[model samples]
Target: MFFADNLKFLRTRKEKSQTAMAEELELKRTSLIGYEKGVQPTFGVVMKLADYFKVSIDALLRYDLSKLGKFELSQIEQGFDVDITGKKLRLLVTTTDTNGEENIEMIRHQAQAGYTQGYNDPEYIESLPKFQLPFLSRNKTYRCFQIKGDSMPPLSDGSWVTASFIQDWNTIKNGTPCVVITKEDGIVFKLVYNQIKENQEIMLVSSNRSYAPYNVSIDDLAEVWKFETYNAFEV
Candidate 1:
């Protein structure tokens, strides 16, 4: 019913005693009991519980206590939040590195069609190529995509661009390079602007300058991955 009920539910569901949970959370048994009995935990302790329980803070605080092991909550805890629009999207697919760390998935040109409709489908996303880069931040979620044309030249075709996943659209900085995935435009590499922030639209600008910039509604926007780094090859 509340955070206490949620915490106690997860602990008892795991068959762990208050003392054991306290030991695991590095809190005293009495403190654990207090937490279970409606005593609010500090932000630090809340974070500890969320991590130890392998669930999101939102789930720990708001989700049904009965659904302790649901995939969505577990996925959120694992740092896999896919915020694609057009539908209520949540991707649970993750590929692990040799060290058992999850890597970002790379969307190939051929998969663009399926990606448009099945981006939210775990089966679809899981089938994409996934790899890790040593330069990538472990805490941030990322993805690699290869551009199709010279729209953003002289980067050219087949150049691999890696971008960090952006969940909040408002945080999108104006004039920043990004890979904008939408229903109308499957995927386009362009400079993004928040000029239409109040209208829930983004202005897409091309580097070639010959192409005029246009605005797209956020509802049509599927995924916006902000450019981080790119790998280019010379002939």
Candidate 2:
């Protein structure tokens, strides 16, 4: 099992002492050592470790390559038609050609309909074409929004961005760009770096080297969404 290697990497990167990590997980130092030494831990212990590290079991075990086929199959098995009512949705830009531009127009029309719902039924769920985004295996519901800042630089600007919900944190990697929400600010997209400490602090690194990284407390985070990609409208 790659558990030992994974544990060691995470522990060293986090700069966490074995004893300290063990105490937090209610595990003995010897057990933690064994995990780092390639001892295959039980499923329960593996789950606990995965939770402690804020990673998926597959990620912690480094089984992504071996389990990709199985993971896709599992997603298929679990996939089901979801009703749009009460479920959050966003629009994703699929292409940049004329067809893609037409799709954006269609989305705008739907948004207008939803906005003018008072003329009919305010709760009516407007149906729009659904498209699957690359990188993200799951089909995402998207909504179009205007990008207002240079934080995302070349990728986003005063253009349309399709925002989607991010439910899993394990898929997030250090230094990868993402849209994060805190209790204080609703949404801000930037590169996220794993902080040195396990405390609430997280380093929000900007892609533009000119800007400095800002530290934010984890307790203030309400949501963190990965910016899959974007289509920029030239100004």
**Best TM-score among the predictions, by candidate number:** 1
Q: Per-candidate TM vs. native? A: 0.59, 0.40
Q: Which stretches of candidate 1 lie over 4 Å from their true place?
A: 1-92, 233-235
Q: For candidate 1, write residues 61-166 as lDDT tens digits.
A: 8656454235434454576442223234444345677788878788777677777787777777778877778877888878888887877877777788989887
Return the number of clashes found in candidate 2: 5
At residue 171, candidate 1 shows an lDDT of 77
What is the C-alpha lDDT profile of model 2 across 87-169, one tens digit per residue?
A: 22222223333454322211332243342332123233224333434454345533344444676677545555555545444
Error of 1 at 35 (Å): 26
User: Model-by-model lDDT, in order?
Assistant: 0.75, 0.54
